[model samples]
Target: MKTIKSNFNAQGLVRIDSDDLKLEIKFESSQIYLNVISVNPRNLKTFFNLSDLRKLVIDVADKLAFWKFDLTVTWEGDELAYLGQHANPNILQKFIVAKNVEIKNLKGFAKLLGGRST
Candidate 1:
């Protein structure tokens, strides 16, 4: 287990920077909600909903099960939505099990987490 140093500011924002990944999450109210500000390698920043990311992963897993590929998303924006800094492998495993994907390489499937493409 690694320690995540989360930085909080006066404007209700939390930042996490590790190696080559930068994550800026913002909190608006007291309802325990946060919006991802930027999760990228460099020169590229983006924001996306967590729920949307899970859906995209599940969709990709489905397509992978059907077509057999690492990344086949055509839409460019869809690529951005799938990448997130805080996406744990446990989450992926849960989605894979829930989606009934009989794939073991589902872990570390997000090769785009640090903006790597193949």
Candidate 2:
């Protein structure tokens, strides 16, 4: 695995920056896998196939199964923020298994102790 020199500030936020963009990913626990993404609003179709994992896809699925859902995420904002709609307590535990990402509660820990996004 390749190692990236990254740091989490006192507030516990992981900031990632590259040539094209800058983004922040906050972990409630300590898992590297997340369920959110941002795509070109006008051409999401073009970016849709870029990856098989979509964090909102996972979070929404989780919300569908259970009325209330606890989650962990890492992705661009605004685009993925709408997922809050699924956070209702009435539908949180409906799905036991889902094909998409896994929902984890980070609770304030960090994952990927020394690795970069794959």
Local error of candidate 1 at residue 91 (angstroms) = 12
RMSD of each: 14.2, 13.5
lDDT of 2 by residue, 50-113 (tens): 2333444655654533432233444432122222323332233225324333434222111211
Tens digit of per-residue lDDT, candidate 1, span 1-118: 9645433322365666765445454443311122333345332324445466656556655543343223222122232222222223356655544332332233223444443445
- The lDDT of model 1 is 0.38
**lDDT scores in order:** 0.38, 0.36
Q: Each candidate's TM vs. the true structure?
A: 0.27, 0.28
Residue 29, candidate 1: alpha-carbon lDDT: 31
Please give the TM-score that candidate 1 achieves against the real structure: 0.27
